[model samples]
Target: MKNNFYDQNIHYQFPETFWWGSAASGPQTEGAALIDGRKQSIWDYWYSVEPERFHNRVGPEHTSDFYHRFKEDIKLMKETGHNSFRTSIQWSRLIPDGFGEVNEKAVAFYNSVIDEMLANDIEPFVNLYHFDMPMCMQEKGGWESREVVDGFVNYAETCFRLFGGRVKYWFTFNEPIVPVEAGYLYNLHYPNVTDFKRAATVTHHTIVAHARAVEAFKKLNLAGKIGIILNLTPSYPRSQESGDVAAAHISNLFFNRSFLDPVTKGEYPSDLVELLKERNLLPAVEAGDMEVIRNNPVDLLGVNYYQPRRVKARKEPEPENAPFMPEHLFDPYIMPGRKINPHRGWEICEEVIYDIMVDLRDHYGNIPFFISENGMGVEGEEKFRNEEVVIEDDYRIEFVKEHLKWVHKGIQEGANCLGYHIWTFMDNWSWTNSYKNRYGLVEVDLKNGLKRTIKKSGRWYKQLAVNNGF
Candidate 1:
């Protein structure tokens, strides 16, 4: 939270081979949601049924229209000094039926997008899923059903065979735990189930799907590295007391290590497993699921750090008839004087990124990783527009600079960190919240036909990319 985290006098040059770019997803950016053989995803279905849940009643059907304007967008990416970019392939678009023939038009569109990026000298980092499940698959018990897992594996294999030759950085899932938490636990996403047991199954099956996809990617002998993107929020105890520390430990087990350990270390944290077993909330794992997860570990990792989680020992007893939840083990501890993002209501603890890097270096073999998604999403950013019609978003530039300083320090300390990609390249649609908070280097004016204008941060980012530092 200190303003002195970034010393302007220091020339923090990154490696020459560092990737410089940002990330966006198909579901959030690509419009033409139901066109050219595209089918409905969970977002589409949820919007149709409960449009009121979305901000201003806006749905996913008409996003930033990336489908039609990708060529223009790639040009903007180049203008902003993007050498590498990450985005997801919509499963519903690629395989509309979820278990049937591929959609050739969708194939043509994605191929064009990838080819366009290649032509623009931009490397494409394609993710397989981004919380966008096909409605048909969701109808078939979603992630709870093993059949859906097999279908997802098939879909991933199809993508590998189709686009693996050009795209060298592939991600199996973007924040796989988000769906498990949002849809199953928090009721923030579609199917709005609040059952912890069901949530456990969903989480397990998602890991199974990821491992199977990694297995498939390796089997294909593709010229690409496959991994998963995880949003890791490091948990901090309110105090160093034994009870509070134990609470933080359990919090880490549920939120961070549950996925991190299995994908990287090839198994779940033993204590996490024991905890779940003791609660009778363990997911149904098949005989060879563990082997699949163990044998096929990710070749790379994409970390998205936004904030740290503060926790303390639970002070309240759970009612006997209450549904079980992770919150039962700990209570959220709001640290006094902690910096907060008023727009998003998230704490701003920039040092957590360095802590994450050091932890990975010490405990997780220092696996090759990158800052996959980091940015500040501000509401009513138009208020910051200058006379030049550019958003003078100095705050975003400071946010990136501060985080990158910690990233540079981590690299200096021998963390195998590779690159940093902001949360998005352009302002695009977000889930439920829609475009309520703008987080982009380039501004997309939805009121003006999604007009694309480079923000001041975009200019700064270009210089940062060119200089390999700020």
Candidate 2:
């Protein structure tokens, strides 16, 4: 009844040329896990043992079935007006055992997926890791062991040699800090060891693995850009008091700058290093490790912005013998009237995205980057279906519009942001959350054979992609 095709894409129009697509990890979307010689990722093993931990008792193996239906999915990508898409080659699927002979079926599957996207004019942005480590690797100390680091390098090298010509954009890891905080500190992920020393060690080895992968890519003179994805939470303080400000700074240093500095600036923040030294928590660094990190920086950066971290100065000294943590330096404080996503409970402060971009521009040399993942999830979205049977997710449309405006502002004020991709392409199985929270333009019906339907937001995204903004 109305012509609103270019309504959102205009006004805050993006650059004439930029990436337009969504991001998905292999474990979340590929369901033929045990079909093609694919071994168990930690999520697989964890789900098998503790299905109660996962929402609805749905496991990683029960996703959108991308493994068997990527061709049709690529057609949907074209319908949604995507020029580029991002996904990972599952480490567990590729190597299956982490450090052993490669699975030829896994290689062929990825090859076909990449080719299918290209055949449909959808460029693929490939990431090496997305929190789905082979269970065998986890059993062998995971990221804490140098052996895993070597295994990671060999895997990366193999990927380069196999798919470098077709895939030009590569990321070493996605959200490396999450596993450190969840598994080691908060005990939210597997091998839940609440040891600060081991967490620090894992963080160091992750950095090493990323740097070595970059080194491998550069040494081969590959034809692609290699980088890492970081879910950057801009730390906000309640007041401008020096103490409160310092607390926020400490939070940022410990979380954001921990991996950001070494990947982009070639080293960790001096203050953080000193703080670790004072705590006797500095990770054991080997000869040439720092050199590798310092010498090899990423060619691109992936920014996954979901929410901001708000903190204030600690009111009292932390209890003695309380295990060491970044939280000990600051206290969580809920801002009085911050906006929030009703379904997900995450605060919706779109301005923080601009804050991160500005900081990167002013402090980190304005590196080429993109908004890799940003979206809102609403529970039970099928209730919104109109007479046409399409899920009318207008709230999602508004959520994306608000964020894109900030992206436009960043681009205007001098942040070298290149693109924006939503958190997902379809409603698929999230690791622990499963499908409880729907964050896709396309809704997947789990009760009915995983039926896929394009929501209203999907059509809007098609227009947004065609218009290159919105």
What tens digits encode model 2's per-residue C-alpha lDDT throughout 319-438?
A: 678889888889998999889887889999988899999999999999999999999988989899999989999899998898898899999998999999998899988878889999
Assess candidate 1 and give its TM-score to the true structure: 0.97
Q: How many clashing residue pairs are found in candidate 1?
A: 0
Which ranges in model 1 have alpha carbons more than 4 Å from their true place? 1-10
Best by lDDT: 1
lDDT of 2 at 41: 85
Superposition error at 354 for model 1 (Å): 0.4
Clash number for every model? 0, 0
What is the TM-score of each predicted model, taking all chains together? 0.97, 0.98
TM-score for candidate 2, please give it: 0.98
lDDT of each: 0.94, 0.90
Please give, for residues 1-470, the per-residue lDDT of candidate 1 as tens digits: 53322335548989889999999999999999989999999999999999999999999998999999999999999989899999999999999999989999999999999999999999999999999999999999999999999999999999999999999999999998899999999999999999999999999999999999999999999888989999999999999999899999999999999999999988999998998898899999999999999999999999999999999999987556788899998999999999999999999889999999999999999999999999999999999999989999999999999999999999999999989999889999999999999999999998898999999999888888877787
